[model samples]
Target: MTTAETTGGTTAGVLAARQRSAELEELIRKDPGRFRVLTGDRPTGRLHLGHYFGTLHNRVRLQELGVETFLIIADYQVLTDRDVAERLDEYVEDLVLDYLAAGIDPERTTIFAHSAVPALNQLLLPFLSLVSVAELGRNPTVKDEIAQSRQSAVSGLMFTYPAHQAADILFCKANLVPVGQDQLPHLELTRTIARRFNDRYGNGAAPVFPEPDALLSAAPLLLGTDGAKMSKSRGNAVSLAATADETARLIRGAKTDPERHITYDPAARPEVSSLVLLAALCLGRDPRDVAADIGDKGAAALKATVTEAVNEHLAPIRDRRARYAQDLGYVRRILRDGNEIANEVAQATLDDVRAAMKTLY
Candidate 1:
């Protein structure tokens, strides 16, 4: 696991994190104008609990707040690391279901796939010029991903996905990105690219791109049960679509320290800390506070608490997911409409980009 995964705690612990949250809240609350927001997930597989506590919950909240949000199903990005073309559609569709199940309203938030927006690929051409190879290599997120890849060497597409991500955000003129605290670096890189493009090509006129701010989540991303990251490959993830009994079974079988006292000391008690992290995120309390409350409690009680809280959080989502799954055609239509919206938004941005570069015929 990377340092980000190891440091399993909420953002409330830090002063700068609080300031950033305040700034983002001010933007979300006080700013009357429509704020363009962009965010998404890769179509690797079904999203898990880590996804909810980390990012998806924020997406739902922002859209409810009336932000003009665009949620991308980054289908093409799935090809970056793995050759899963045959199963791409399956993963993408399941990802959409998870998004909708998580309360992302199709009427309010435009949800589209990366492969559907052809023009989105064009933005990467010029965006690729704004950064250096060294900069891409230096991206902490990318480095972490590359380090974690099973493949011996990172592919070119994998290396340049950040540039593609910039295209994902800038193409829609997203001025704010909802991200975890660990993802602040990637957003900073996007800001740098936007700044570079405006400085070089805008010629002291209207800036073509917005310097997007990172709307950081107050909760830290939860790790897998085994103290590793919460990913499918690790087999440590609990899916959003998992049955209640299945969830309980997984939590029951999860690892814990032999000492059995539920403390939030991540360094000494990583496995137990991970459960505490999950419970704290679910209950909206500090991990230390949670640890103190459950002091000297055995692992059985801790596991039961995490399982119950997680199930409570997932109950509504499961209800919505079942209803949405009943009519597959309706879900497809929502994705199609979202595809059109994404295409239109992307084309307009492409036109503006061509005009700024004087490349339009």
Candidate 2:
């Protein structure tokens, strides 16, 4: 279904996605080699707890399942709505460190930067032609991004975000993409582009690309300490690389309601409930159960509980991060190796694209 037609995030939509996810999981469990997964993040800043729970953990799980995984750093995408290129290199390395610390093995998953793969970017030219300006404008994910960026006039890159993302997925011929509900529209656009490209250019030959399916993550959206969606730009996120003291300080300052009695009412008291939710996610307990355990304990006890749970859960990851941080050369080499592999894959895909389109002279 097209993004315009489907009611994204509705009960029905989520149910459908869950069903598909179940089927995909079974397929991967039985024969992981049958799928290739493409997933990534824009290196806007250091990844936070939201990244860890929402997507990073899943990437590691898929890799351990023996699936071929391609993780793009999306460095070029940083210019889409904001210009934080000054710290681009630092942010990219931080992402690599976070990935490694979070258990994304470079030996199993190919981790590369978008700017480092030329043929991948080259595919954007033909991809742009297959999509429409209106469709791109109507994309819910693009609309949300523009709203969040608060740009008065959207840049060309921002306008073409979906098509560029399509290129990112299709370049490696990846058959699966890990995503959250909000990202479903963007993935649908990628599917549309792949279908159109094959219909127009395949000319009865074997299709050059797979219409990738979403391996939907079951993790709930993690709220920042400030009770809003976790975001690095907002200064509310707890980075995976944050020191234990820093994490404690941040959670201690989190915005909780003045009410001494705490309960899990996300609608009524989002701040208090967010803290409760964080503790629950870390504790592997239901939010209601966690809330009940902290019954009438007030915000101080809640924050303390959350702080301890977060730190304890992250202790091992932090140790690994510290070790990886000391070896900058090794980290850079991992990126270099990933970029080499990506370049090779992208070239082969581009060659097929050219052949399918009869553009080979």
Candidate 3:
């Protein structure tokens, strides 16, 4: 289904669904929770609104709710696309800056580079052995990614990305894995590994891995200017770091319907529909309502209005990002402290995992 349909459906179910999720999340929040959270970004490019709305924003919310948040810099995953491998350092730093700029509060969130955590990688071996080749191949995420890449020969790492993700979550003993609807399959695999390890070693004493549930986000998907998926690689994404002029230029260049008059009909007029959606998100109003307010205003006027709204929304974030960027020391200190906390928790989990598997030396 299109994002519009998904948004509409979510709006219908949101009241009850959000109540349940929030209640459960609050339970996890109040206690000195054993329920750890594992969520991250692949360091292929700087993050954009899609990243913000889809996950990062929720991560901030989760942190405030008191879940121990581990933000993984999936640096290794960058190798999935060959072109990105050469620029790994630049990309990793940009990812860090983006996270800091987006109000992640490194003080509250544990941020670490995937490659820096060796013990986590070590867990991959025993974790990998628990799942079969057939099981990995059956994962819908792997299948979709393969189809998207159009590659006949997939990397073992790419095919076993779920396992790596399992290692990421299991290494932190994460009880909650916040994911989009599309990511349920990978979370299922993580749960399987957790259960298997607990059954093998826990001897019914205590659960080693908490089977994580999907903390499905209720946020609307933000489309790119051209009405496709908002991805940095697609050249359609609006970066969090974009200057006012750049944002205005991009919004001005955004595709709109030929109707001249503004209306929000996603199916028939995706371009203008996308603009309306963006305006709503920025202004915190319903897209339909925003369109009605526009009345007979031309698309040009609508785009100009949206451009101003977007810039206004992003200006403070951009300014904050600029300050953090100037002081690399502050950024480093934040990540360093986060990494220390992450490693401490990860080490405990890995120790338990090793003892459970009898891999301890």
Candidate 4:
């Protein structure tokens, strides 16, 4: 195909995704109970603003809308690249704390870790059989993960990451997953596996799984303080757990352009524009308007603007976080209850799978 054809096709795909997402939002608003969402994070470390606005905030919104939500900690997946077992316990609890602080209600959502649910992990075995080695490798997300990890070779879990995610989604029979454009490929793989599984085993009856659709986030990617993608390892992220003073200090040191005149041209001034964008997200305004508000202000003034907005926005969440931190036992109970619920649901799904395949004793 010609370059024009490829570009046109890509543009069409993006437009279609955006339309579907809008439709899904409408459906969720009308009858949120009809949708089940399976989305999560790897407990590698603290949750940052990128995570809060990019996905966490959406999770809370969905739960409040009465959607059946399942949040997996993805504790086992953390070992796919590195060994952080020493702090794994701490990290898991920290994630729960952040979730609560960010308004994730345990009463409304199911928050669990797979390591505590054997049946959920057991789904991985059958899921692996439904996918091919080449298909797994073709997943762009897995390829990027392998490349980024810089490992001499990919581990089995790393190679089968997509299938693992499929199990995570399918076990709960989730019909909607919140994701970014980059993560569309992962959801596609999950949809493919769900279709293939039903084709192979459904025997002209009810399908065993629902192919989940992508609820693409409307939020733009929040960049790090250094003008790069916000990441925990890069040390550019503003952690939700950070104190008010710490948040101010981090934003104060954020990178910005040398130009005295502030603007929100991301293509040309990524660093400055990113700070403006962050402040804009907190203030619920357009980045360009935020820039216009800071016209002629130097980077110092821009940084100050961001610092104040971010801290003011996060004050309530941090207050909630500190109060929750005082009782780790309550956090632990939430995880425990979520695990019990997950095990029940996963066992029921696994039984259905066995029955569909006629493998049940």
Candidate 5:
């Protein structure tokens, strides 16, 4: 989806995007400085390669830079469009293991499930009042989600996910949010809601929340083996839990163009380009460079190369995930400890919000 479709056909994204600096990413690269960041993913399943290079990898890097990072396992977000009533616990557990396997340190980063943070959810009640149905419906990100989920009757929760996201961002008082090109509109909505809340209620002394800026990642959009969007629900994604043989089989079966000579033109050959992007991510090289290396090599060679590179890269992650899976007790403890820390921060933010609005009575 373009900015037109993603930003709800408004200039809100174009305007708010001015503050989102690629320079900030460069700055972080050079100095490794500290900033408070709030970023997360819905606990639908084990994160795939789309996640590793997209967001989860960035989360680990940010934490290592001493930046105060909060990783939210948005378990509640799963219910926004679909029902995970039976598999919610299994989903949450697998997500936590994926976090650990991907190197998200529980000691350094507070990785809490959204449902575990009651105070955070409570903040959503007041935040819901701050944004209207029109405003929420106009959210391009939400609209795109509703469309993708194929839900004709949009749920109230799905409609107001941006507001819930605003609550998530503001509750942590985050100043930097690491996101991709697709998430800019949602982040812009968070900024709008934060400014709206502060202007209305925090005009007296101090603003309660700082509008967070997008810390753009270096990775591009990763497509699944089928050259479509990488998603578990679609059954096209390469799971982080996939063994070497499984990964190889998936890559071997991936879609590629009929061209005899491989090239990296996403518009012309999206299938090959998707594999090119994946290769670049796995080996940390330019996609164009990878394309050149596969010169004269046919589709078979291209798939073989991608299969080898991906398996080599994900081997350690899969191993670590297996180790974490064995110790479910340890994983539960990590979540519990993270919940305590997250609650403290969330409750403090909610208390401040109540006091600012004078709704504490």
Candidate 6:
């Protein structure tokens, strides 16, 4: 089977398994009052389409559900691979701007930079001691990162990233983690650590960490204009903050097939199919219906149609972002308030954790 077939089959199998798993029963048993969700982005670059569809859009939905959400700017995770940490401050600031511009309400949600929270880092040390080095090596995310980087040399911090991630979730006592299918292992590891810590230290007291479960999203995986993965490094990603002219230029230059007529056969014509997907997402129409409406239109006409649809879709978001970008002080104030809220919650969790371990006086 081809890569696409393999991916499709795996997704189907996972869906079938999920339908049978006692997920609903477990959810009821946990009964987390209101979902305390923890999800975050690494401060490596500006948010792009993959980030938007894969997580950010769902985050907006979760927030609307009245779930208590905490968005972390994973600044320290940048050190896992990138050597230079000098410009990290600026990178984190830009990330905060991106979140605000994308409609993540500072008033309703807590947002904080990872490095700014000392308690979260402190939790990491004990969390690391709880898990073994060999176990960390077995984490699927760690393996993927190593393969992606193709690095002969790996850092100890990089190797233990899952533990740090566990710290991020456990430090907030988050009970719901919105994640894609690929991140199930991370959630499992977090649950394992929580169970181990509670068993080891509970001593008739409440558990220090709440085991978080994946709140799976049904969002589609958006592909880049180049028909590859939607990523910044590939130069195919359209930025959330892209200007109107830049957006148009990228759409026009996007790769399409040699056929004079446009159709939405993803398997046969991936490039045209990709454009159709983009147009459907932008216009909130079905891809098949959009393809049919464009019937005999050539690729040029299709490109024009897709461009108009996208620009219309992004115009409001762009305007909102511009307004927020103009007031640097307002953004800073939002982050400051958000940081305070997150820090209070994180410190409370850490204090509980320390007390459980008999380290707190």
In terms of TM-score, which candidate is strongest?
4
Candidate closer to the true structure by TM-score (higher is better), 1 or 2:
2
Q: Report, for every candidate in turn, its global Cα lDDT versus the true structure.
A: 0.83, 0.89, 0.78, 0.87, 0.82, 0.78
User: For residues 1-361, what per-residue lDDT tens digits would candidate 3 score against the true structure?
Assistant: 2121222124533343344456666676677255678899887788888887778788877777777788999888776644337678777778888887878877678899888777888888888888899988888888878777734566777777889999988788776777766676677688787778777788767887787655667767677988788888888978998888988888888887778668888888887888888888888988999898887888878988888888998888898889888988777777677777767877887888777767789
Measured against the true structure, the TM-scores of the candidates, in listed sequence, are 0.89, 0.95, 0.89, 0.95, 0.92, 0.89
Q: Write the per-residue lDDT of candidate 4 for residues 1-361, one digit (tens) a residue.
A: 2111222125565566667889999999999989999999998899999999989999999998899999999999887776345588999999999999999999989999969888888878888898899988888888788888845766788887888898999999999999887777778778888888999998999999998888878977778988789998899999999988899889888888779999999889888988899899999999999999999978888989999999999999999999999999999999999999999999999999999989899
The count of backbone overlaps in candidate 6 is 0
Write down the lDDT that model 2 would get: 0.89
**Of candidates 5 and 3, the better by lDDT:** 5
User: Residue 118 of model 2: what lDDT?
Assistant: 97
- Clashing residue pairs in candidate 1 (N, C-alpha, C atoms within 3 angstroms): none
> After best superposition, candidate 5 residue 205: deviation in angstroms?
0.5
Instruction: List runs of model 1 lying over 4 Å from the truth.
Output: 1-18, 283-297
Give the CA lDDT, 0 to 100, for residue 283 in model 2: 85
**Which lDDT value does model 5 have at 289?**
94
Residue 31 in model 2: shift from native, Å? Answer: 1.8
Candidate 6 C-alpha lDDT tens digits along 1-361? 1111222125663464355233632553455346688999887677876677677877776676567889999988987865556577776777777787777998778988888888888888888888888888888788888777634677777888999999999888988777767776677678788888999999978787777766666667667888787786688878878987988898888888788767788889888888888888888899899888887878888888888988887787778878888888887788788778878888898889878888877
Candidate 3, pairs of clashing residues: none
Pairs with backbone N, CA or C atoms under 3 Å apart (clashes), candidate 5: 8-140
Residues 174-289 of candidate 2 have per-residue lDDT tens digits of 99989898888788888888988999998898888898888788876678888777898899988888988999999998989889887999889888888888888888988899
